[model samples]
Target: MVISSDSQRDLFSDTGALGFVQILLAEMHDDLLGKVARFRQLTDLSKTLGPGGTMIHGGEVAYTAWTEARNSFIHGNYIATVMLCQSLAENLLAAYIDTDLEAEKLPKRVSFNDTIRRCVSKGVFDKSFSGELITMMNIRNPLSHYRDLEDPSNLSRRVLDSRLPAIAHLMGDASFALAIAIKLLSLPPFWLSGETLK
Candidate 1:
């Protein structure tokens, strides 16, 4: 059967409820496809610098955790992502420091603060970078612990409220945490040999 021009035009026109619904669904599908494409790009970027290439001990685990943390942040799990990034920084710093210390001489356990101090003392990181890492830790600790507090009036909870301004502040802190994590991972002194550094 030969379809008339008017019939073909009517088929694609968004003039009725059904047409509106169909148009909405098509727009939603396009948006989802765009998101999926972006997600794939991020995943590829995350794997660009592999753990082995970084050369820190336990680098593999830390790199994997970083990728997961990045995914979490992209997926809107900001608080969890910040916490994971902070943990990754700690692990990377510890492993980097342990590289220079004898196995027997290493501490049984070290806190993040102690690890940062050791890194600074060993020249793995300078005082300024050490201070930045400490600041990131400070931001992560309060946010992470605030979720576990039982008291509704806790200072951390009050400061990190659900309001827009508070959320923006948390996002800023998370960005700093991620930036510090990446800096620690890619620091030339940590990854380079003596000859390379010189």
Candidate 2:
């Protein structure tokens, strides 16, 4: 799929925002301002990637919904915002499964990273792609389950650094985790092909 690099607005990195979570949440909702359009973009990708008639998981759609609700939460949409955290968690895994089905041949059972690795092992993606997916998938757990925001060592940064080199500026932030999550879905399988995953 041909995607426009400029389609996603850089809300957190460009706005000079202070709070990572608050700013990112706000940016997702500010479609008119063009601060960032990650929610819209990811949703579109999820649909496009599943064009083959396979049933895409609700979790994938929920994750995109959580991203949208996060913005609404900032604007006092309490009902929607209250549930985004958990919804996002479910979505992440769902999206992973959707990616699994995209493969020409799929394994019977595997985790999100392993599923991606299987694709790489088939020469669909290079070994480095598996490593990156593993790192990002590993990080998603802490990001989804953690409660304290004060701690600087969060998984989102590690995942982002693995994908987007520019995110190195804020490697300890959890809010950007969603951005990384969506980024994982955005990348094409072709870009990751070449090396063995092991």
Candidate 3:
């Protein structure tokens, strides 16, 4: 029986989904563990955390999301894809700041505008730096789902149109999500500025 392209795509896509997660996990493995260890070192060195630190809490949350995503993917649970995508997004965002750092130091919200603004405040990114993170989230959402979108390519194109240039500027012609993740990792939580800046 000849497999329709859609069916072929579905099979291929499911495989790709797993591959994407695996690659993401691999790329993040050292970084994530290193960050956790570093956070402990920073806390020990500073001796300045108050009774409550969102960074510590955020680390726990990131770990929880990671576990759920990992378990779902390993068990072949359908929702694993979505959970993993969200986990990736959340961890990427959390990595933008010191997990043990103060929350007030960050913007009250997590928007593209807020991220850029915060970066500028830190003297890292300039105000002219701009991109639409929400748009990328939409693209990620559908890709994480099993239902066929009306026009996946169109959606992908739209995200590319909005975010590709900014991404290329940062990561040299990478996908928007990757660019964002790279930028996030390079910043406070990972603090491997010199390594990733180039």
Candidate 4:
């Protein structure tokens, strides 16, 4: 990861000028923070997930992923931001279920969809919010799972204007991901002002 003159030389020698140019193409764009047109849709999201309060649980891994998701969105890595946001949601719900349910009552951690169902059934969150989480989950499934040509969710078959780029969709998806994450964090045991679960 350490960059040096030798590495630069090697990169140029291995890929030639064309490949080197391609590698930096995405990183050389306009200020990504400024490109985020949808972030202004919810300015108050900061009041929820911003760096003012302490997280109540011991899920550092999830928190780190959430941080990286935010970083990715700000830095123009929209695909990574969307995927990581879904991942953070899945992990956060799992962490809550592990803590709230008894060992005998719990089954395998299983799938994110299943986890969401269990959480709703157990009163972890209501159906309305679960619908939002489900949308996040569905958005991610198309990215991870390969689909046939007829599947609209398949990236290869998705409808788009011929002039538009994939990043256009990804930018919107990443923005929605961040908003959904804020909604999740703003709910229940995660966002108690001074109240503790008994």
Question: Against the true structure, what is each candidate's TM-score?
Answer: 0.61, 0.34, 0.33, 0.72
**Every candidate's lDDT:** 0.69, 0.45, 0.45, 0.74
Q: Compose the digit string of candidate 1's lDDT tens values, residues 1-198.
A: 999988899778548998889888886576476456546644554443434455545567777778777776655466777788887987877877777645324576889888877877877779999889878877776665654545543335555565446656666666677677767766765453324434
**Candidate 3: residue pairs that collide:** 55-99
Candidate 4 residue lDDT tens string, 1-198: 789987688666667788878878866566756646434544556576524443534387688878888778777788888898887888887877778646335456568888888888888789998998988878888887888868777665664433456777777788889889877777656754555559
- Please report the TM-score between candidate 1 and the true structure: 0.61
lDDT string for model 2 (46-104, tens) is: 45332232221344566466556546533434333324433543444435445664555
* Residue pairs in candidate 2 whose N, alpha carbon or C atoms collide under 3 angstroms: 59-91, 125-192, 125-193, 126-192, 126-193, 126-195, 127-195
User: Which residue segments of model 2 deviate by more than 4 Å?
Assistant: 1-109, 145-183, 189-198
Q: Which ten residues in a row have the lowest lDDT in candidate 3?
A: 166-175
Q: Is candidate 1 or candidate 2 better by TM-score?
A: 1
Using lDDT as the measure, name the better of candidate 1 and candidate 2.
1
List pairs with backbone clashes in candidate 1: none
Q: How close is candidate 2 to the true structure, as a TM-score?
A: 0.34
What's the distance in Å from true for residue 161, model 2?
A: 19
Query: What is the lDDT, from 0 to 100, of the residue 5 in candidate 4?
Result: 88
The segments of candidate 1 whose C-alpha lies over 4 angstroms from its true place after superposition are 1-53, 101-104, 147-164, 192-198
Give me the candidate number with maximum TM-score: 4
**lDDT (C-alpha) at residue 193 in model 2:** 36
lDDT for 191 (candidate 1): 51
